[model samples]
Target: MIRIFKQLLMTTLSIGLLASIVGAQGQQTVEAASDSTQATIRVDKVDNLSSDFIMGADTSTMISEENSGVKYYDFDGKQSDLLTILNNNGVNYVRVRVWNNPYNEKGQGYGAGNADLINAIKIGQRATKLGMKVLIDFHYSDFWVDPGRQVPPKAWQNDTVDQKAQAIYDFTSNSLKTLRDAGVDVGMVQVGNETTTSGICGVTGNDEYKLFAKGTQAVRDVDKNILIALHFTNPDKTTTMLNYAKGMAKNKIDYDVFATSYYPYWHGSLDNLTYVLKTIANTYDKKVMVAETSYPYTLDDTDGETNVVKTTDDIKPAGYPATAQGQAHALRDVINAVANVGPKALGVFYWEPAWTTVGGTDRAANLPIWEKYGSGWASSAVIGYDPTVTTSTYGGSQWDNQALFDAKGHALQSLHTFKAVYTGVNEQLPDPMLSDDEATIASLLKNPSFEETKMSDYQLTGSIKLAQDTPKTGKNALNFYGDTDYSADASQTITLDAGTYTFSPSIQGGDTNASSDLAIYATINGQTKSVKVAPLTGWKKWLKPELTFSIAKQASVKLGIKIKSNAKSWGTTDDWILTKIANSDTDQSGSSSSQASKTSEQSASSESDTLASSMVSTKSTKNDVSSSKRDKTLPRTGEKVMIGFGLVGIVMLASVCVIYFKHQAS
Candidate 1:
């Protein structure tokens, strides 16, 4: 009977232990869910603003060419419509260009897309069905219209300025009416294509404004809400673009947006593009956009066509290679640049991203077509129709390498870059929590120190640990030991405006078996610059290392520490700081101070100095080491606390087993 009683007691104790464990687990689950809900709320407040921004692409040649045997494939090689692919990838806008007449008297097609009114209408209608916004780009010519060749159609060449203006109005109004009649929703329209220096229909100077005004008036007459865009090329010519805008204003051109063709290879630097966009947005109070842009995914020729964008000169703007990833990076940077201009900067449209190498014969086979129907006076000037000796060909697209679709018609990774939108609201938007100055001094880094056990915004490797011992200031420091050669310790990526910045960190070297060094490295625009900290003499003292460098443009930079290879190398780092240097300062480390001075300044600040006193109190209470009060460490203290609780639970379970066994013996 006693044995049975003891067995019952033991079973009861076991059930009780299991219940306690389950109860603890349920409590943890509830807390985790609560924390996740709070985090989601914070994220939605920032992400919801992106809904107002547009991400668009230009597939002018997609419909006609796709019907003529060209096809587009997804990453998995499944055939997909160009618009479907773009829309699926987060592109909300599709731009289709329209030409007046692209066929000869004999009806011989003008091989390059033959982007006539009907073709454009078909494309726009399809885009609308997909629920994507349509942007109709009116070329105002019989063929392609660009900065170099803005020739008027043969029918309109002989017309007077007033007559030509009427013709433009009639054509634009009629075409827009046709699209709208077909149930197409046109959100935006470009009046002219790339009228950088001269205007179309043989117009020049202020007369160009008359042409623009006529087209814009026609657009407004059709639908007053339709946004009219005045297009230009070469954003580096700031003075020229400004003058053009001024002339349009003088002529009272009723345009809603200013658009630019910003091909980095031809138009100049991304910096120049940013400056021009910002200037236009601030000066004109009009929406600005990069109407046309493209980067090469590969420099190698896929067909007989000679690739135009080959060489370092072409790909240097974003310093990305001519690979799939590089193309994505370049496109992302361009979009980000436009987003940086605030809400007035609409978005970007990648030019001919779906023009893959297909359909037409080789250069030799297409020579006769070029000579007979394409070598007319107008065709001879346009490169698309030029019948040269036969080396290069337009039969296969010269821009196939730059297309978002690969040679096999598969959509490249670069297509996905268009989906991201800038979510930052305008500074004028009221925020109760932030003062004007406080908002201006936003910290670029999320976690600048290793005080917390968890590291956010940083990628870490090679035996990284948050050590409580030997911290320079905070309660903890980032400890790294690289027994192997050239290992990355920790890195954080930061995006900054065009300026100089100083990266400073306090480091202490642990005992080393051989000569070793800790190096601070900064990578910007595909270039890496590194500086070595002092070698370890002893663990008693900490050394502060600082490196300053200038970024020629607004760019994303990777800053990190690396341990050089040796027999044995280890180090501890704390109190990391990154500060932008004043524009007037030439020295990279001009804003940095010695460790002793930093300590003295902290000590000298009185309690009445709210800002300084608050900063100190935060460092002590929150265990944050960043110099900026706005920077907060991610909470990782729970990791250690959870571990402690786990150990305690294990001991308690063992004690219950001992007590039950002792009762059984009695």
Candidate 2:
């Protein structure tokens, strides 16, 4: 049942994304370019950019990409070095975001360009050779950092605030010295990336600004001429942005430039973007610039990893179409927006624009590459540092379609926007009519079917993964279990209004002879309810058992599949759903609907025992399974298991046993 609401609450955005493997997948996704010529997106230049206006692109991952054998081509399709291509397109600055350590204790690179000091050195050296300046963005964390997170490096986890400030100064000073030694033109240094809410080192508000002051002091000591920049994002919140700007002054955080990340998608309108920056510039007498901005040329997944902007609705926030020309217009307009803020506007940096497609349209084929080559946004190795790296959010780039280069590694028309902003693109371009899938559903839960195989929404445990052995319907199913006795589940939490809902989980795997138990469980408030599935007799066979429950008010509910199995017990589960069938103001125990739901659950359990017993009897007749009582079993999602031969064996003489013996053929 497809339930279309005003919006999808269950899936996407940073939340919408942690899950999605469908709506955009395999094959050439965007429509072929049109033969008829159309006018290229033109920009209304305002002072355009003086010789000092920064045209920057975050090519932080280009090293890993080039190492992976990707080649960069100019707009004309001629092979060229990346820096040279950018230079030809009027790009004068290269922004490189560096992490303290994006690796695990095993020393494996945690992908996402493995943004270590070494890569920064390599990129700085290369970009400087072409006369382009480098902006060294220090995230001050082992992994990615933004407004939501500010984990201090492990080495300084236990340090005091004063100690952290000193450590920040020393680290920044040493890193700048290293870059200078490498014959690189280090033009600017960013204290932190998007340090608005929680700035750095697990600190909040004023504490965050203090850390930035230490970093700024180090930059000033290293090179007075080098711009000391403080970066923040979200200009949409005028009051917040203004107060943050004022907070910088109140805290006396000395910095030369104030940078904001202005992605047209999530960040607010261009006018607001200008107003926020202009206020800071005029008030503080500090230079301002856009630290990051990007727009997708298409809503397709070029590398099988889901694209962040995978739907038409995504660009609606920015009012831009998903096309190469549309991408150019968005970028060009941003450049003009910053330039219009007077000469104090330093420039705009297109964040990771060159992070093009590195893998094919199959995540299975791409996951290993992501783990090894530092390609994906995050890797399994980073799970050590960032607890958020799950089976779904760990691998592959969600920003590929938004890259300046096409999936084929050729520069898109958007790349020329840097130069075209001032000179104006005179050529008539192709329409390149492109469209995306419903991409996102307004479902109560945010997730995908196995055919998508991305496993976008669920947090899986143990041996569970989307297996392609034999799908329940499409190309894959949720599979779990191994030779050893283990408990596994794929769970996702959802928020819903108070009402009665039915949860039905489809399952398959093994035969009636299997000793494993596959059940669907839902956790509402503090209580958990579950229903076991019937025995599956065929590899393609699937059984769904319904469990209904009620909540009195708006509450968070956790839903997922639970497996408790003996040794060598394995199973596949798929298409689990929770549907709200009614709305009543009655209590769960008093409502008729609740009673019916409980009765349905009991009926389903009775059927499971009857069918599972018959399958077991057939297997016993063939001498395929042992008659002795199995040892361990996982009953609920997090319930303790019975290891030894508990009283459960003696309790097996129920109707299930009676049915089993009657069906037995001696």
Candidate 3:
């Protein structure tokens, strides 16, 4: 009884200790020391300053009272539409994309999307009227810049790479000049749209630094103060993009900022988006933004022509309530995520926030304006239309009501929430620690070059198997958490953002029959290191076992984990577990980059799985004895102690029950 009571006391102490540890992990807000002499800015001044800095919206659907109920103007008639509202609210800038001519040869107008000097002037006029800065987006081509297409303007159709370069220069210079003359205050300009395709007429854009330099330089020449941005589609493709940017920089292409389009439905998830932004920002010393991002309010809408699509394979199901209210929540979530990125995260620009309604002629295929002119010129309308009138496939409007303001122009409640909440750039969050192995694996998984990956923040629980003869070749071959694992022994690689991390395993040894030895390893920059573990013996309760290590912030490195067994002379790994935790690389570490050295000649032992029982084998020996026997003998001091206390209480209750029974019988 004494021994049992002692055991109970120890178990209670252990649990209490764990609870204390967890409590210590929480962050505490500290009060600043009082300093009455410090200069204090007026509240009004701070409000004005904040309004001038925060700009996060897309007004493609922005309309004036003269055209439709949806007006960029506010309730106060004194203020002009969007610009004034932006100036008053925290929107200091706006981005406007321009397309070449957007007109048919017949001289008919192609509408607002046209980069014609006339429309540019009009848009510029509106911007100036609102006292907002404008960003001109030159698609270069007469149409859109997309992954599947990059149609050069008619003028440059037959031009050589050199001619194309000149055309780009001439186009940029002329466009900027026209906007400048119109009294528009230019803030930034995008040289091109998402360009990840092959070159124009055989000139490769993937690494065509010379061509990129020419185009960017042309824009820079127009106005040195205007921030020049290089845009791409995916954030995770940092290395590929960095290589291209480095090439451009090498050739003297000067641009002010770096940007990428990170639509999660098209990219992956917020985590992936964060990984991409943090990595790129840390790699290149440039401010960045999530140039375009959006989430669907519902999956019910058919993805006929809208940017949001309904696909079964999204990382997560529609996040909103699948209703307008849900969409607001989703949008809020996205905004918060972007805000969480902090200062390095300049801000977010919700793509086409005003693309609420589809217009009548927007998607008329084979029409001169859309097919021949390549501008969707005849189509592209921001208002809803009678579906009965469409004789063609792309005639309905899908974006009419998704605006911050309703179709009737009343601002949504979320707008006020947004206006009040978004104070400044989100401060970068601290990095969590990771074990050396976890860091290496995360780094390898994040690198886009490694190919297939599925490392989502999604919680997963399951058993995995690797081949004995060739451990990585089995049915459930272990893979990098980020990449897909196909066969046994197949290696995967990934590049990670800078941070400290903790690597941990989910699968315990008790569940597997084979005596496996799991090895975790990391190679930062280039240096390689390894950590070893013994296999589990059987079914076990979950525990938070972690490995902590520090890695350079934003360092590009390779990480890996392999499993093997000792008895079979043939390795067999039935279940494997691995993960990472990252430390805040910045603030804690200096800016200098580091190099890694590979370990000296070390031959891996042969694969073997001698134990045949489905039960966990004896490999996890704590040196004193095998884990299985020890587990049974010790009763896991903690678990035993609890059991003892529980039994004592149960016995006491039973004695009470007996006394009651005897009294009743008497």
TM-score of each: 0.54, 0.61, 0.50
Cα lDDT, model 1, residue 43: 9
Write the residue-wise lDDT of candidate 2 on 1-666 in tens digits: 123321232221223222121212211121112111222344434454787689999999988888766788875567889889888777899999888877888999988899999999999998999999999999888888886678889888998888888889999999999999888899999988888766677877456666878999999999899998888876765666787789889989889999999887666558778888998999999999999999887766778776666654345446556666668878887888888788688899998888888768888888888788888888888886787687667878889889888887887767767766666554333322222222242236665455564666788987677654333343345766453477788888888898887776667666234666777788987789987777655443556677777788888998888776764355667556567866845544466655686657653542233546544543442231112211111111111222111223323324334544454532
Model 3: lowest-lDDT 10 consecutive positions:
36-45
Q: List model 3 lDDT by residue over 27-138, tens digit each.
A: 1101110121111111101122223333556543243212322344343333245545554555556777776665556654333244455555676678777777777777
Q: Give me the displacement of residue 286 in model 1, in angstroms.
A: 0.3
Ranking by TM-score: 2, 1, 3
Cα lDDT computed for each candidate against the true fold: 0.66, 0.72, 0.45
Model 3 clashing-pair count: 68
Candidate 2's C-alpha runs over 4 A off are 1-44, 426-666
**Preferred candidate (TM-score higher): 1 or 3:** 1
Candidate 3 regions off by >4 Å? Answer: 1-54, 60-89, 109-112, 198-203, 238-242, 298-307, 310-318, 323-343, 358-393, 396-398, 423-666
Give one digit per residue, the lDDT tens place, for model 1 in 1-666: 878877876776666566557556755755663442122111002233246567788887775456546678765567877788888877889888888877667676565567777877788888999999899999888777665467787688889888889999999999999989888889999999988644765686556767887899999999999999989976655556776677777778899899998775545556667788888888888899999888887666565555666543234333445655456656766777777787797878888888776534365553443434332112222443322313333344667789888877877755656553333212232221111121122235665555345776788886665554344443456766532444547788989887767777667764554556578889998899877776665452566666677786789999888775453355577667788764533443544355335534432232122446434543342221122212221122254455455556666677777877787587
Which TM-score value belongs to model 2? Answer: 0.61
What is the alpha-carbon lDDT for the whole of candidate 2? Answer: 0.72
**Which of candidates 2 and 3 reaches a greater TM-score?**
2
After best superposition, candidate 3 residue 599: deviation in angstroms?
49
The candidates, ranked best first by lDDT, are 2, 1, 3
